[model samples]
Target: MNYINKITLLFLLSISVSFAQEKLSKEDAINLALENNYGIKIADSNLKIAKNNKSILNSGYLPTLTGNAGATYNKDNTEAIFANNEVSILKGAKSNRFNASLNLNYTLFDGLGRLYNYKQLKEQYNLTELQARETIEKTLLQLFTVYYKVALLTENVALLTQSLKISKDRLTRVNYQFEYGQNTKLFILNAEVDVNNDSIALLNTNQLLLNAKRDLYVVLGKKENPNFYVDTQVNFLTKLNKQELFGQVKTNNVSLLQIQRGIEISSFQLKANKSGYLPTIGLTTTYGWSKSNNNSASFLLESTNTGLSTGFNFKWDLFNSGRTRTQIQNAKINYDIQQLSKQQKELEITRDFNNAWEEYKTKLFIFQTQEKNVETNKRNFSRTEEQFKLGQITSIEFRQAQVNLLNAQSNLNSAKYDAKNTELKLLQLTGDLLNTEF
Candidate 1:
C-alpha cells in the first residue's frame, strides 16, 4: 500500500510540475476564456434555439396533413318483435368495424398575419444573435480586465522582490560598517527592520499574485492551480480621438442594434394584431374510408364507404370587445418605449465614451509623469547610495530614496493598467473588442 501511495504522490507531483512549466500568454488566455466561458456556452445554446425558431416551417407557411385509422369488434344477442305477431331471435352476433382518414389544411389568407408573424420571428432571431455578441463582448472585456490585473500584481511582486534585495544588501553594509566601528548599532537594527519589512511586502504581493491567477483560471473554467502564471508585461494603447470613437460607437454598438431590433419586433407585433380586423380564408381537404362486416350467420353482411372533401373557410373578427385594438395600442406603446430607450442608450453611450476617453487621457498623463518620476528616483537613489557609502548621508535618507523609487514604480504600474482598462472599455463601446487580435 505504501508503494502505491508513493506512486500516486509521484504522479501528482509530475502533473503539478508540468503545469508549473506551462507559461500562459495573453492570446492563449483570451482564447481559453472565450472557448470555455460558461456565459458564452449559454449564449451559443440560445443562438441555436433562435435559429431553429427562425425556420420557415415554424412560421406556419406550410400546410398540415394528417392520417387516422381505427378498428372495433363486438358481439351481442338481440330479439325483435314484429307488429303482425311475428318474432325473430339472434344470438352471438359479431361485428367488425374499421375506418381510416387523411386530412390536409392550408391557410389561404389571414390578413397577412402569418407573414407578419414570420417577420417578427426573423427579427427575434436577429435580436438573439445580437444578444449573443453582446455577451461575448462583455465576457472578453472581463477577461482582459482580469488578465491585466494579474499582470499588474506580477509586476508588484517583482518590484517588492527587488526592494527586498536592496534592503538585504543595505543590511549587509550596515553590519560590516558596525563591525568596523564606523556605524551605530541603531543603523544595523533599522537596516534589519527594513529588510524584514521588504520581505513581508514581497510575501504579501506574492499572495496577491496567486489570488489573481486563481481568479483568471476560474474565469477560464479551470480549478485553481497554484503554479499557473500569466505574462507580466504591461501593454500600452495607441492614441485615439473622441470624434472617431463616438462615430464608431453610434453605428456599431450592440446595445443600440438590439434596441433597433426591439422597434422592429414591436412594429411586427402591431401589424399582427391589426390583422385581426381583416378577414381570414383557409382551405381544407379530406379523404376517408370505412368498412364493416357481420359473420354470425351463414349469410355475410358488409359495408364499405370512401369519400373526398375540399372546402374553403372564411372568418372575420368584426369586434372582440376592443381587445385587438388594445393589443395594437399596447404594441404601439412598446414601440415608443423602445424608441425612447434607444435615445437613452445613445446618451449613455456618449457619456460612457467620454468618461473612458477622459480617463484614458488622465491615465496616460499619470503614466508619463511616473515614468519621469522613476528616472529621477533612480538617479537620486544612486546618488544617495554613493553618499551613504562615503558617510555623507544618514542611512535613513538613503532608505527614503529607495522607498521613493519603489513608490514610483508602483504608481507607474497602476497607471499602465488603468490605461489598458480604459482602452478595453473603448474597444467594447466601439464594437471592436471581438475583432481585435489578442
Candidate 2:
C-alpha cells in the first residue's frame, strides 16, 4: 500500500465514523432550543410572573378584614375613704380584662383608580408576553444563523475532500509519467505541491466545521460537544411578497406590539394618576366585645360590653403641595414619550424589513449565478483533465481549472446559506418565524 492509499483509507474511515454519529435535524435543533435554552427559560419565567400579576387582588379590588384580641391582668392593694366618714381598706385587689375586635374596610370608590390599575396590569402582562416572544424570535434567528453556517462549512469540507482526491490522482499520474520518461521532475513536484495545498485546505475547513458544530451544541443547551452531524439541506422561502410582509410587519411585529402595549399602559397610568385628584370613599365596619372582673369591690364587681358599628368615610386631597398635579403631569409626559417611541419603532422595523428583503433577493440571485458558474467550472475542469492526460495542456492550467471549480462550489455553498439566513430574517421581521412551518 502507498501513501496515497493510506490517506484515502483513513479518510474513508473518518467519513464512516461521522456518518455513524446522530443526525440532528433543523426542527430537532429548534425544538431543543425552545425546551432547554437558558434565554428562553428565563423569558418564560418572567412571562409567568407577569401572568401571575394580572389579578384583582393586585389591583386592590378586594376588601381588607382584620381581627384583634387582648387580655390584661392587674393586682394592687388600695385603701379608700368614703364620704360618710367611714374608712374602707381593701388588700390584694385583683382585676382582669379581655377585649376582641374585628374590623372590615372596603374602598367604594377612588376616582376609578382600581379599574385603571387593573387595566394597566393587563397591559403589562401583554407587554411581557410580547417581550418573551421577541426573545424567542431573536434566539431562533441566532440558532438558524449558526445552523446554516455549519451547513456551509460541512459542504465546504466535502468539496475540499473531493478536490484533494483529484489532486492526489493527478500526482499519481505524474509519478507514472515521470517513471516512464514522459514527464519532467518539475511536473511531478507541481502535482505534489497541489496535493499538499488541497490537504491543507481540507484540514482547515474541517476545523471550521468542528467549531461550528460546537456552536450549535451551545445553542441547543448541550453541556458537551455531541460531535453530531447536521442536515446540510437549508430550506428557503422564495415566494415571500414585499407588500404582504410589510402588512404583517405593521400588525404582527413583536417589538411593535410591545410598543403599542406600552402606549396603552401609559394611558392607564395617566388615568390612574388623574384619579388621585378625586375624593376617596370607603365603608368601614367593626364589631367589638369587652369583659372586666374585679375582686374586693362592693357593688359592680363584674362588667361586660359588646358593640357593632358601621360607617362611610370620605377623603378628598384638597391639596398635596402640588404632588398629585406633578404626578399627573409626569404621567402625561410619559404617555407622549411612549407614543413617540411607537412611531419611531414602526419606522425602524419598516426599514429593517426593506433591507432584509432586498438582501434576500440579492443573495438568491447570487446563489443562482454561482450555481451556473459551478456547473461551467465542472465541465471546464473535466475537459482540462482529459487534455492534461493527453499532454495537450500544462499542469498549471489544469491546477487553475481545479481551483476555479473548487472556489465556485464554495461560493455557491456560501450564497445558498446566506440567502437562507436572509429569508429567516425576513420571516422574523414579519413575526412569521415562529408561526411558519420549518
Candidate 3:
C-alpha cells in the first residue's frame, strides 16, 4: 500500500468492526430534502393559500347579484292612509302580499381603493412565492451540511478501526517480548490502554455518525431508510472567491429574502392604509317589485308597485379621531423595522462566512503539518526499533517510539477529516455547498 493507504487501512482496522462505502452526493441529498422536508412543505402550502386569496380583491369590481321572493297574508279592522288625502275606516280588512326581485349593483367607482387592493394582493402573492423559494434554499443548505458531516464521521470510524487492529497486534508482541525477558509489564499495560482508548474513540465516533445519518434521513422525510455512507475523497481546493460567494449567499439565503418580502408587504400595507384619506366613490342601484290585495269594508282591491333607482355614493373620511393616520404611521414603522432586520441579517452572513473561512484555513495548515509529522515519526520509530533489537536501547525507549508513531498517525487522520469538515462549513455558510457535487 502507499503510505496514506497503509496508514488508513491500519487506522480503520484498529477502530471499526466493518468499513463499507456507500456514497450519496451533495446534490442528491439537497434535492431530496427540498422535495420532502417539512419546512418546504409548509412553505408550499402557504404559497397555495396566497394564490387562492390574491384575486379576492378583484371581486369588488364584479357586480353584486341577489334574488328574493316572499308572500304574506294579513287581516285587520282598520283605517288606511293614502297619499291623495283619501282615507277609509273599515269594520274588517285582510291583505295578501307577494314580492320577487332580482337585483344587480356594480360599483362604477370605489375611490380607487378596490383597484389599489387588487394591485397589492398580486404583489403579495409574488412575495409569498419568494418566501417558498427561501424555504427551499434553507432546507437544501441544512441537508448538505448534515450529509457531509455524516460522510466525514463515517470515514473517521473506518480509519479508527484500522488503528485498533494494529493495537491488538502490538499487544500480542508485547506479551511475547515479556515472556522472553525482552519487555516489561509496563510495556504490556501501555499497549492494552491504547487498544482500550481506540475502542472508546471508535464507539463515540460511530454513534455520532449514526445520529448524523439519521437526522439527514429524517429531514428527507423518509420513513424507511438505508444506511448512509459518504464520499470522503473530495478535493477541498476550489475556485470560489468571497465576492462571488457572498453574492450567491445573499441571493439564496431564504431568511434574508423573507425579511425583504416582509418589508415590501408592509410598505404596500402602509400605502393601503393611507388610501383611507382618498375619496371613495361608488355607484348603487336598487330595483323593487311588489303586489298586494286589500280587503276592506265590502270590496277587495289589488295593487302592484315596481321601481328602479340608481345613484352615486361618496365617502370621504375628512376627519376621524386620527385612526387612519395612526395606522399609516404604524405600518411605516413596521416597514422600516423590517428593512433594518434585513440589514442586520446581511451583516451576520458576512460574519459567518469569515468565521468559517478562517477555521477551514487553520485546519488545512494543521492537516499539512500533521501529514509530514506522521511520515517523520514512522521513519524515526523504524530507526529506534532497529537500535532496540540490537540491544543498544532499552525496551521502554523502543515502546515510546512505537507509541509516538501511532499517535502521529491518529493525529494525521483527525486533521484530514477536520480540515474537510471546516471547508464544508465554509461552503455551507456561503450557500455554495448545496451545489457541491461529489
Candidate 4:
C-alpha cells in the first residue's frame, strides 16, 4: 500500500510540473527547428531527386533489354486464282498469327561521352547535398537569432517589473509622507505616473516576447505552448585567429564548394558536347519467334519461324548545319561562365568572413563595456534608493537612478546577444556552425 501511494503521488507531481512554464534551451530550439523546418524538408526532397537522377542507368552507361509480343486472329471469305486460269473459292477461312521478340542494346563507344556524362551526374548530386547543407545552416542561424530575441525581451519584462515594484513602493512612501505633511502633492503625483509608465512598459514587453515566440514557431514549422521561457545567457567565442579561419572557410564553406562543383559539372558537360562531333558505335542483338495458321474448306497450313541476329551500329552527325558545333560552343561558354562565377563566390566569401570577424570584435567590446556599466549603475541605484529612504535625496533623483539602472541592464542584454549573433555568423562562414552548439 505504501509503495502504490508513493507511485501515485509521483505521478501527480509529474503532471503538475508538466503544466508549468515550458523551458527551452538554445540547443533544444536549434534541434527542433532543424527537425521540423519546412525549408529543410523541401531541400531534403530535392537531394533525393538529385540522387535518383545520378544513377548510372539514367546516365546511359548501362545496357537496355526489352521484350515485346503480339497476336492476331482473322476470319474471311477468300478466292484464289492459279496460273493455269483455274479459280477456286473458299467460303470461310480463319487465321492466327503470333510474334515475340527480346532485344538488347548497349553503347560500345561514344567518344567517351558516357563517361563524362556520368561524372557530371555525380557532380550534380554533390551540388544538391551542398545546397541542402547551406539551407540547414541558414535555418539554424535564423532560429538562434530569434531564440535570443525572446530571451532579451524576457529580460526586459523582468527589469520593468522590478522597476514597477520600486515605483509602487515609492508611491506608498510618498502617500504616507504626504499624510504627515512631510512630502508634497507633486511627489505623490509623480510617483503615480512612474508606476503607470512601468506597468505599461512591462505589458508591452510581454507582448513583444509573445510575438517573438510566434516567429520561432514559424521557423520550427509547428505550434507550441506560448508560455515557454528560454535560457537568457548568451555565449560567444572569446578568441579567434582570422587567417586560420579564412583558410578553413575557403574549402569548407558550402556556397563556395557548390560553385566549385558547378564548374566541374560544366566542364564535364562541355566535354560531352564535344563528343557530338565524333562518331558513336553501339551493339544490338535480337531473338524472335513467329507462328501463323490458316484453315480452308479442304486443307489447313501452318508455318512457324525462330531466329537470332546481332549487329554493330555506327552513327556520325557528319554535318547538321553546324548545330553540333553550336551546342559544343555554348557548353564551353557555360563552362567559362561557371569558372567566373566561382571566382566571384570566392571574393564574396572572403569579404563576408572579414566583415563577420570585424563585427564579432566590435560586439565583444560593446558587451564588455555594457557589463561594466551594469555593475556601476546597480551600485548607483542602490545608493540612491537608500538616500531616498533616509530623506537625503529627492524622489525624482531616486527615480532617475532606477531608470538609469534599467537602461544599463537593457543595453547589456542587447550587447551580449548581439555578440552571440555575430559569433554565430562567423561560425556559419567558417562552416563550423553545424557542429557547434549555440
Candidate 5:
C-alpha cells in the first residue's frame, strides 16, 4: 500500500512540474484559436466565395464573347453525265473546308432583371459577411468558456494545496503534543484522519485541473497538451449599461443583420421574377471567315467568304403554361416568409439578452457575497487557531474552522469565474465580445 501511495504521489508531482513550465495569457490563447480553429477557417472560405460571387460578370452586367474555329476534310469518288451524252469520271476527289468566328452577345434590356440580380448579389455578400462574423463570435465564446474553466480549476487546486498544508501542520503539532503528554491518542488519530481527508481533496482537485487543461488544449486546436499554465485571475466588465447594450445589439448583432439582409434579398428576388413578364432584348454580333475547296466541281473549284454580321434579337414568353406567374407568386411568398423570420429573430434575441443581463447581475451579486464570506471565514480561522493553541478549543473545532475557511475560499473562486462567464455571455448577445479586450 505504501508503494502504491508513493507511485501516485510521484505521478502527481510530475504532472504539476509539467503544468508549471510556461504561462499562457488569455490574449495568446485567443490568438492561437483564431489562427488554427477549423470552424473559423471554414467560415473564411465561405466569405471568400460570397465575395467572388458579387461580380459584374456573375450578375449578367458584362457581355459574353466567344471564338470558334474548325476544319473539315473529305475524300470521295464521283461520276457526272451531261445532257449531250458526255460522261466524266473522277477518282480520289478531295475537299477541304475551314471556318472561324468571333461572336459577341450583350443584353440590351431585361426589364430591370439584371439590376435586381446585381442588388441581390450584393446583399448576399453582406449576409455571408455577417454569417462569418457570427461564426467567429461563437468560436471565441467557446474558447473563453474552456479557458476560464481551466483557470477556475487551477485556482481550486491552489486552494486545496493550501488546505492540505494546514492539515499537515496540525497533524505535526498534534504528534508533538502527544509526545509531551499534552494531547490524547484520540486527538492524534483525528488529526491524522483530517490530514488524509485534505490530501484526498487536493488529489481530486489536481486531477480535475489536469482534465480542464486538456479541454483548453482541444479548444485551442492543439494536437497535444503542452506544459503551460493559464492566468488564474478572471476579469469581467463591471460598468455595462443595459440601455446602451440594447442599442448596440440593435445595430451590431450578426443574426439581426443577417435577417435584415435576407429580407432585402427576398425583395430583390420578387422583382427579378416579375421581370419575366416583360420582353427581353439583346444585341448579337459575329465576325466570320470561311474557305472551301472542291476538286470535283467544274464551275466553282474554290470559294472563300469573310464578313461581319450584327442583329438585334427579341424574346417574350407570351405563354409559358403560367410558369412566370407561378414564379412571381412563389417569390412574393418567400419575401413574406423572410419578413416573418426577421420579426421572430428580433424577439428571440431580445429574450436572450434580457435573460443574460439578469443572470450577469445575479452572478455578480453572488460573487460579491462570496468575497465577503471568504474575508469573514479568514478571521474566524485565525481566531480559532489562536484559541486551539491556548487550549480553549478542541482539535475537532479547530479542524472545522479550517474546513470552513477552505470551503469559503473555494466558493469565492467559483463565484468569481461564474460571474465572469456570465459577463461574456452578455457581451456575446450584444455583439461586443470581439471588440472587447480580454
Candidate 6:
C-alpha cells in the first residue's frame, strides 16, 4: 500500500510539473530576451553612447564663459630723484593687490566640423538601433531552436515510455506461458534487453532536457534568476510555403536592415570627410577687466575698467600632407567593403532559402511515407507474435519483429519533427517566420 501511494503521488506531481512547464509562450520568451539578453544590453549601451556623442557634437555651436581671480604682493627698493636731479635715500616698501576678471569665448567657425560630426552621430544612432534589432533576432532564433528541441525530446520520451509499457505487458504474458511450458525463455530475455535499452534512452533524453532548460535560461538572460520558470507552450506555425517565404526576407530580415544601415552610415562618413576640405567660419566674443600696480603707492596708480568685444574667425587648411585625400580614400574603401558584404549576404540568403525549400519537401514526403510504414509494421509485429505463440516462428524472428516496430515508430516521430523544423526554418529563411499570422 505504501509503494502504491508513493507511485500515485509521484505521477500526480509529474503532471503538475508538466502543466507548469507548458505555460510559457513564445511572446514571453521574446519579452524575456529583450529585457535580459546580454547582447541587447550591449546594444542599448551603445545607443546611449551615440546619443551622448550627438549632444556633445552640438556643444560647439554654443558660447563658453570663464572666470578668474588672483592675489599678489610686491617689494621694491629704489631712490627717487627731484625735478632738479637731487638724489634722496631710498627705502623698501611692499604693495598688496587683489584682482579678478571674467572672459567669454564663442566659436566663429571651424570649417563645418561640428555639422559633419553631428551628422555622423545621427548615423551612428541608426546603426545602434539596427544593432539592437540584430541582437533581438539572433536571440529569438536561439530560443526557437532550444524550445522546439526540448519539446521534441519530451514527446519522444513519452512515446518510448508508452512503448516500454506495452513491451512489459507482453513480457508478463510470455512469463505466464513459460511457467506452463508453453513459451520459450528466450522471448523473455529479449524483452528484458529491449526494456533495458529503452530505459537507457529515456535517461539520456532526460539529461538532454535539463541541458536544454539551462540553455533556455541563458537565452532569456536569467542566469541569476533560477527560480524563474520558463513557459514552453509551442505550436508549429503552418500556412507558410516556399512561395511566400523568400518574398519577405529582404523587407523584414533584421540582418538586411543592419546592412542597409551600414550603407547609410558609410555615405555619411564620406560626406563628413569631404567637408574637411572647405574652410570653417564662426563668431566669438570676450569681455573682461584689468588693473596694474607699478609703484609703491599702488592704490594711486590703477587702470580699472571692463569691456566687451565680438568678432568672427576663419580657418582654412591649405596644406596638410594629403591627409584629407587619404581620409577620403579610407572612407571609399569602407563603403566598398560594406557594399560587398551586402552582396554576399544576399547570395547566402538565397542559398538558405533554396536549401530550406528542398528540406521541407523531403520532410513532407518522409512524413507521409512513414505513416504507412508504421501501420504496416504494426500489423507485421502482431502477426509475428501470434505465429511465435503457435510455434511457427522462432523467438529470434519475433524479436526482430519487435525491433522493426520500434524502429518504425522512432522513424515516424523523427519525420514529424523534421517536417515541423523544416517548415519553420523555411519561413525564417524567407524572413516571414515571425509574421502576425504565423
Model 5: how far residue 206 lies from native, Å: 1.8
Choose 1 or 6, whichever is better by lDDT: 1
Which one wins by TM-score: 1 or 4?
4
Candidate 5 structure lDDT: 0.87
What ranges in model 2 sit over 4 Å off?
1-13, 81-92, 297-299
- Candidate models: Cα lDDT each: 0.84, 0.89, 0.74, 0.87, 0.87, 0.71
In TM-score terms, which candidate is top?
A: 5
Candidate 5 residue lDDT tens string, 1-438: 663256348547866696557888988999998988888889999999998899876989899999999999988787877677888788888899999999999999998999999999999999999998998999988888888888888887778778877887887888898999998999988987777777777677767877888888887878886678888876777689999999998988889998999999999999998898999999999999999998764557899999999999999988899998999999999999998998899899999999999999999999999999999999999999999988899999999999899999989988998898889888988989899988
What is the per-residue lDDT of model 1 for residues 201-265, given as tens digits with 9 covering 90 to 100? 76667667778878888778776564656776765656677888788899999999999999999
What is the TM-score of each predicted model, taking all chains together?
0.92, 0.94, 0.75, 0.92, 0.95, 0.81
Least accurate stretch of 10 residues (summed lDDT) in model 3?
13-22
| lDDT (C-alpha) at residue 297 in model 3 | 40
Q: In model 1, which regions exceed 4 Å deviation? A: 1-19, 80-87, 224-226, 295-300
Q: For model 6, how big is the CA root-mean-square deviation?
A: 4.4
Q: Model 3: per-residue lDDT, tens digit, 1-438?
A: 644345446546633533453467765676677778889999999998888878764547787878888999987888767677788887646779999887776766555667657766777788898777656656765665676677667766766676666666677777888999986899888877777776777768777887888888988887765565666565676665767767877886656766777777787788778877877766767688999897864344888999887888777879989998999899989988988999999999888878877787789899999989989998998898678657688656766786687678768767877787677667665555546663
- When summed lDDT is taken over every stretch of 10 residues in candidate 4, the lowest stretch is 3-12
Cα-based lDDT at residue 180, candidate 2: 96
* Candidate 2 clashing pairs, residues 3+ apart or interchain: none
Off by over 4 Å in 4: 1-19, 83-85, 295-300
The window of 10 residues in a row where model 6 has the poorest summed lDDT is: 225-234
Maximum-lDDT candidate: 2
